[model samples]
Target: MTAPITQLKTIEQQLLWLSHWMIHHANHVRPKVDDIKVGGHQASSASMVSIMTALYFSALRPEDRVAVKPHASPVFHAIQYLMGNQTRDRLEKFRGLGGAQSYPSRTKDTNDVDFSTGSVGLGVAITSFASLVQDYIAAKPWGETLPKGRMVALVGDAELDEGNVYETLQEGWKNDLRNCWWIIDYNRQSLDGVVREGLFERIEKIFDAFGWDVVRVKHGVLQRAAFAKPGGDKLRNWIDTCPNQQYSALTFMGGAVWRKRLMDDLGDQGDVTALLERHSDSELAALMENLGGNCVETMAEAFASIDHDRPTCFLAYTIKGVVTLTCRQSAKASR
Candidate 1:
């Protein structure tokens, strides 16, 4: 790994631990006045950690602004704490009265939150408007002196179901929005369940119609490297064709299940079988689970590859609670 990638991975792990720990502390350790459970979206925060780490630590400039996903408040607050923008007391008081707000708030939060995000799709919608406003300011003589920056939204995949997001897309198309980015955490799994298969195809079409560039980040470095092997193409095809729920379940079930499924499907094929034999169960499991959005290096590369000022959407594939799963596996192995 490059020095930058190493640094990013370290930061990613720290954010993952801090965010989950904050949630655990809130739910289990903190003194409660009532019998209510203090719910923090631990999985949601885990899904965004690598993406946010790449964005904030590697890709983002000082002028850029981001509207963090509402459910990822823990990750955002953890990032702020790492940057010395948040206090330890506030972190300990997460979700409590006079504590870190359940969701990021511009008026309430002491840290530098560019956009207050709480409503389902409001955070995703506002980035386009903010980009428009930025353009409007630049058109003015005095405002031309201000530095222009990208208005970005860290969006949850489920948030795309909101009608207002589509409405904002139409408005943005009409207004010719520029320098806006919506990075969707396309984890497939949502609160209700796994999202409908092929949702990304429809989403791509919608964005294309609205004059926005769509970048689909599906596979990570590990998967891509495997695909370059002798029987890698067949393996890649199998992964591509696998149903979303099945893939998720297999991932949860870990490597032995993956081996069985792959062997059953592609057993007689000499090259494919050899490829499977190359890796142990845990290694195979890790390879299969390393989706693009969950890989900090892959996310950083995606962010860096965007060379235009036009509005863009990065549909980044990830796994919900992947960080938590990894931590659990690590603990189990250590025990």
Candidate 2:
């Protein structure tokens, strides 16, 4: 990787560690006065780390604004902390009095925040409105010198179920929406269950019909690299066709299971089998887990590829939770 991409990747992991540690501390290490769970969404933040890194560190300018997903507040704060815009003190006191807010709170958080997000669907809807408002402002002579910006929202895939999302799409189409991006973290796993198969295809069509360009980011640099190898095509195909739930299960289960599952599915076909045999279990797992949104470089390249002023939607594949199941439990218990 080049220096810039390397830097972005480093920040991505840093944000991930700080965010997860913040949650862990609040939930597991902090002294509790009562039985209340000091909740933080560790998985949600994990799924968004690469997406946010590409956006804030690689793609966005001072003028561009983003409405971070509600569940990803730790990442939002951690990024702020890394940027020197936020303090370690607040991060250490996360969810405590005068510390970072559980959600991005404009009134509460000391660092810069364009839009306060919570209650799932509302922040997403607001991004579209913000775009419309941007247009409205730019149309005026007094506002003509204002720097134009993309109103971006980093959203969880499950959050798309909100009725207002479709309403916003329709309204944006009617208003000739431009300069807005809704980057959906399409991890496919929800608290209730896995997302319906082919939902991304449906979402793409829906966004296309509404005059917004949709970009689906499924495979990453690692998978794309593997695709260039002998018989990598079949491996790519299998990954593309895999079910959401199965993929999530395999991911959580780790590399040994992934190798076994891939080997069993693909059989002893020469090139394909050799491809799998070339890597250790850990290496295999790394390749398997490298979905586009989990990779900062992939996401950065994707964001850079867009040269248009049209409203865009990025369907970025991500792992819902990066921590182990036990850590997930700790996160909730803290909450």
Candidate 3:
């Protein structure tokens, strides 16, 4: 059990490293013929590494299917590369003629991708339809041998705004959907700017109304544990109330500022105060930054706990740019 979690962590680290490395290799190492940016969404991938790690290495079985988020293509490729499901040549020539597609393609890419994703909300919405399709097939006689797998979508938080997503909700509700998981990357940051406030609140109610179980993966195991302590409540409250921009800004500024911000908000009280005091600035930042979506163990555990196979929505909190450097730099520079 723990072994898979260890592998999940390793996978997360490798995705982080390789995703960045791939972009670096493309920009710095490879020869440039055109002036066009070899633009890879680094920040996007960074935000998704832990979720992918948990989903691929731990929670997912051979039967389960995933539609990789468009921006996290590097991470997906890295995982497939590590698993020997992809070739070295593909990695070496990413975004090239014969390389992996900018976004995964079920028909185009060589990897065993369940759903090909390019457009934002389309991919997310499709997962629900796919689950309905699976159920339709299972009802028939010939497809009885079809594996009992969940149709999962790794969705960007921004993608939720797309009208197709709501259309998907209505469709799923109508079809009596089951065995589907829409894991939203609630990073709050998007390509243009940070997401609107209370976006997930509306999403939660929508999911519930549509007969989906809404599981908000806001805090990881560590943060949840910390919240149980004395001053932990205040810290948790601060985190809960902190605007997306502030969180992203604090993260970009680094750990020292994170410590000051946490202390300034929560103050030095008792057990929670002691807990905060014990950690260095960097440590405190790391603690503060542990979004549930970025915690592989927590995600894997969450994925494992589901039994009834209701159409589920995991509102997974993440950073905007988790996997790639190019995206991180761009987002920061833009800000």
Candidate 4:
């Protein structure tokens, strides 16, 4: 790995540990007067760790603004804590009264939160309007000196179901939106259940129709490298055609099950069999789960590859709760 990528990996793990620790502390360590569970959304925060790390550490600039996904508040608070913008006391009291806000809040959060995000689709919808407002200000004579910045929304795929998001898309198209980015965490699983298969295809079409560039960030470096191997095409095809729930289940089951499934499916092909034998169960699991948005290096590269100011939507594939599971396993091992 390059120096920058190595550094990013370190930071990614730190953020993951800190974020999960904060959630665990809130639920298990902190004394509770009531019987209510202090839900910190550990899985939601884990899914966004890589994307947020890459965006904040590698892709974002000082002037850029972001409306973080509501469920990712733990990760956001962890980031702020690392940057010395949040206090440990607040983290210890997560989801409690006078504690860290359940969501990123401009008014409530002491840290630098560009936009307050709470309601499902509201945060995602407002970024386009924020971008338009920025443009309007920049066009005026008095506002000529203002530095232009990207208005970004870190969105959850489930948030796409909101009618307001589509309404904003139409409004943005009508107003000629620019300098905006909506990076969707396409983890395939939501609070209700697995997302519908092929929903991304429809999402891409909608973005294209709205004059926004759609970038599908699917495979990570490992998967892309694996695909270049002799039997890699079949593996790639299998991943592409695999149902969302099946893939998620395999991921949750870990590397041994992944190996068994792959062997059962592609064992007859000599080249594919050789490819499968190249890695142990743990290695195989990591490789299979390393989706683009979950890999910090891949996400950084994707963000860097975008050169235009036009509104863009990055449909980034990720494994929901991957980091949290890893953290739990590690904790058990240490114990």
Candidate 5:
């Protein structure tokens, strides 16, 4: 069997190339009268790439279903294109007449979409209903052959603000929901600015109250390993405590700023200091930004390790724009 790391890297590379090509084809290569920037969520896609990879390639069976986040439509299309579920012609005509729809369409798009998405929290909530449907079918005498696949939702953290999501939660709990996974891309930064602090805490508690398994995927394997070293606890604590805006600003500023900030915050601290000293600016930035949703290997491992049918929530942390340049530029320009 191929190593999970190698598979993850392959998934990452494929997603990176396909998503960028789709955007480039639409904006730069294709003819356009309106210079309004066909606006794809490159940053959002980047945040969910690894998570999707793990979910599709490793964690999910043929029966499992996913609802791609709205901004991640490009990445979803790109994945389908690679899997021969989409066409080059359609990709070339993205956001155009008869091209790929802005989001997955169970009825409209030609590709295979388990669920239609675009209305934000609606997509996230639908998975719970799907799970309920699965259970309802299983209870039927004719549904014995129905595959026992989990219904999954890839949610943007910003989507939590939508009241429909909370409504879905209540309904799900009332219905004794099971086997639904809501994997949230908690990048902290949103379309406007950083998300409100402590928002996720409230979310976690709510999920817990509803009997959902809340797996907080705050750090990747690399970051966890780093945190295990001497003084690493301090570094990890610092990262956990860092403000959302500061984290994003440093990402935009690149590695040098990351190093300077780390030193300033946790300098002269034994093992943490040595650890920072070992990595260059770029390396440090990569280390600091090693979020669980961006680590396909970690995500796959987590998914595969799940043995229960309980409603689970993977609060996966991520960067708003790790692999896409256009996404960042557009977000900045809008502000």
Candidate 6:
């Protein structure tokens, strides 16, 4: 049996490399007539990679259906390519003639996409309605053969800004939504700026009110393990209390900056100083970056936690544009 974590890492690297390479090929390798940004949303794709990897490769069965986030088109296509459903030629010509579309489209692309998604919030809203439709169908005599599939949505945190999502939530509650999941890529950073503080707290309350089970995928296995360590509690507290913008800025600054920030903030409080002293900068960066939503293992575990198929939402924290050089540079340069 293949180790899930190892497999997750392999899928993560493959998706990251393939997606970014395709974007790079289009922008650089292909001749440009008008100097347009042959854009693939690198940062968005980066944030969703692990979650999708865990969902598609591990959690999902053939019957399960998912609506990919609008900006995470590259990762979805790359996953299809890896699964042998997509061709190399089309991947090379991405966002071009007969190539993979900017967003996964059932009619435009040859890949077996469950739903065609483009605009934000629409895909998410459709999932809840889809669940309603599924339930509707199953109640019929002709729908006996149709198996119940989990209707899932991979959504960006910013997409929650759309009014359609809330409308769907209220509708879901009214219809008794079940066998559906909305996994949010809570990267904190949006196109405009960092997300507001305690946004997820508000979301959690809203979901609870609407009768949806809210699972917060905050700290990954590493951080959770560390919480048991001597000074791990302090580090966890620091992470919890840190503002979204500050956390994102520190991450973009990289490992050395993370170390300095930790030292400055905690200042030898408990085992934090000893912990900082023990690991190298790179190690520290990784430890800090191992957010529960970013970790495929954690995502897989979260996905598994839902056994009864009640309507569920996973608030997954992710890093925006971690591996993509262009996206990282753009985001950093903006600041």
In TM-score terms, candidate 2 sits at: 0.94
List where candidate 5 sits over 4 angstroms from the true fold: 1-3, 323-335
Regions of candidate 2 where Cα sits further than 4 Å from its true position: 1-3, 323-335
Prediction 6 global C-alpha lDDT: 0.84
Q: Rank candidates by lDDT, best first.
A: 1, 4, 2, 6, 5, 3
lDDT of 5 at 88: 89
- Backbone atom clashes (below 3 Å) for every candidate: 0, 6, 7, 0, 0, 1
Q: What tens-digit string does per-residue lDDT give for candidate 1 at 92-117?
A: 99998777889999988899899999
Best by lDDT: 1
Q: Against the true structure, what is every candidate's RMSD?
A: 3.6, 6.0, 5.4, 4.1, 5.6, 5.2
Q: Which stretches of candidate 1 lie over 4 Å from their true place?
A: 1-3, 324-335
Pairwise lDDT winner, candidates 3 and 6: 6
Model 2 gets an lDDT of 0.85
Per-residue accuracy of model 5 over 59-110 as CA lDDT, tens digit each: 7778888998988988899888878999988988888888887888887789
Model 1, position 239: C-alpha lDDT score: 88
Compare candidates 1 and 3 on lDDT and give the better one.
Answer: 1
- Cα misplacement distance, residue 101 of candidate 4 (Å): 1.2
How much does candidate 5 score in TM-score?
A: 0.93
Instruction: Tell me which of candidates 1 and 4 scores higher on lDDT.
Output: 1
Model 6 bad stretches (over 4 Å): 1-3, 323-335
Can you write out model 3's per-residue Cα lDDT over 1-335, one digit (the tens) per residue?
43365556656777798888887777677777877778788888888988888788777878788988998899999999998999878877788778877899987899888888888888898888888888889989999888878989998888887998899899889889888998988888876787888867877898899999988888876677677766777888888899988887887777688877776876666765677766665556566677788777678888877878888888888777642221122222112
Candidate 2 C-alpha lDDT tens digits along 57-124? 88997899889998899999999998899988898889999889899988888999889986788899
CA error at residue 58 for candidate 5, angstroms: 0.6
lDDT (CA) per prediction: 0.87, 0.85, 0.79, 0.86, 0.81, 0.84
The residue ranges of model 4 lying beyond 4 angstroms of the native Cα positions read: 1-3, 324-335
